[model samples]
Target: MTMEIGLNLFSVFKELNEDYFGTLEKVAEMGYKNLELITVNFSTCERYTDTFSLPVIMKKFEDLGLKAFSAHEGVAPGSVIIDADWDRIIEENAELGCQSIVFPMAFISGREDTLQTAEHLNLIGKKCKEAGLSFYYHNHAHEFRRIGETSLFDLLAENTDPSLVKFELDLVWVMRGGYDPLTLLEKLGERCDMVHQKDLGMHVNPVNLFTATPQGTNLDTMKIYTEFVKPNDFVNLGTGIVNFQETYQKLRQLGYIRYAIVENEGQLGIKFTSIESDLKVMEKYVQGL
Candidate 1:
């Protein structure tokens, strides 16, 4: 099965501030048929809840010729689980025609936190299953830290119910974590349904979860690191170290035919040029596949 190419709306969060609907229209115009929503604030959440109901949002997507396949909810650990607000969250996404609800990132401290995260994911996954949506965990580099001999990511994969919890593997962050992306894919196997396609320019140090920059220094403050020492950062796909051709071949071999979402946290560096270039690169990759 061939995977569909999609955009994680977070890639253009800054541009969306200028023109919300227009930004989405631009994405559709760029040939992206699917979108993965990112909810970072109440205002963003209310954009979907207060301004547009699920059916209204669905109609808008249909009009734009786009499909809402998945959504990333809650930025951190404390906010990731299902709570009193889950019904509304689930209802809204369900109405928007989203099949997956992904917890984008969790600021984990150690083994205990990792286990707690796994338990929370199981609970959330159960809730999602009851609501007819699948639950997934999107990883960053922190998950690669070793808990004894087993990586926290492996622990999470081993502990969670395979049917309840899957993963959205961020290949760039996997590389940042100093692990082979394909090796992790081999381990996760069928538990991985979605992928975040990104590439790294240099070797970034493993994230310090307790520190100020969990996901690397913000692009704005990147100059600070450069003044003292060079900082490894995300670069556009194909222009970086990731081998997409090999990665795509492995995904096909593993039967990963779900969404392959192109993501660029470094869009600020190249603005829209690199994003468009990377999308075209992914488009070409998908066509060849």
Candidate 2:
């Protein structure tokens, strides 16, 4: 199956907060038919939906010809987690016509934390399945921290149920973690249900994040590591070092992978122009596929 170009709303977060409908219209006009909605804040449970109800949101998406294909959820204060109103969250996402509910990120310190997170994910995934929606776990560079020769991500993969849980692999994070995304893709195969495409600028020193920063998974350590990742470290889709052609080809070969989502991060100042450039590059890649 040919993969479609999609956008993660986090790209234009500032614009969305300022003018929700206007930002979305611009996105649709730029040819993004599918979207991965950022429903909740990473640090807090403040939901964008709290400002607008489900029906209103659905109507807007329908009117614009945009599909809410996936959504990001997490454990924030008052946010949708395993303990907090998860059933309602699932019902609401289903009502919004979302195909999948994704747990965006986690802070893991060690093997136990990783395993526990995986167990919780299994529970969430089971619930999502019963509600007729797929569940996915999105990764950051922290998931690649070594634990007994194996990465935390590997441990999570081992602990989670294949039938219940899948992954939305972020290529930039995989590279930042000092691993080859293509090789990781080979290992993940069909379990990688989606991909977040971004590129590393040519000027990024050491290239691998783990190389310069110490391997620590705590929040403070993570923040310290983030400080090392400058805004310029990220470039538009095909302008940097990532191999988009191979990535698209690999996803097409996998046959089950769906959206190759455009994740325009670290370019907030020019989010509109960045995504437009990304779409041009993505179009070529998809055509090749």
Candidates in order have lDDT scores of 0.75, 0.82
Over the stretch 1-289, how does candidate 1's per-residue lDDT look in tens digits? 6788888988887776566677788888777888999644334544445654566667778999998899988743355454536667777788788999988877764678778889988988888899999999998766776656877788888888999999999987776555888888888887887999977664544434213344443322222244422333667888777788888888878886587889987734644676778788888786672
Please list the Cα RMSD from the true structure of every candidate, rounded to 1 decimal place: 4.8, 2.5
lDDT of 2 by residue, 32-71 (tens): 8999998764334467678788888899999999999898
TM-score of 1: 0.85
TM-scores, all models, native as reference: 0.85, 0.92
Candidate number achieving the greatest lDDT relative to the actual structure? 2
Where model 2 places Cα greater than 4 Å from the true spot, the runs are: 41-45, 77-81, 214-221
Lowest summed lDDT window (length 10), candidate 2: 215-224
Candidate 2: clashing residue pairs, number: 0
Residue 260 of model 1 has an lDDT of 86
Q: Highest TM-score, which number?
A: 2
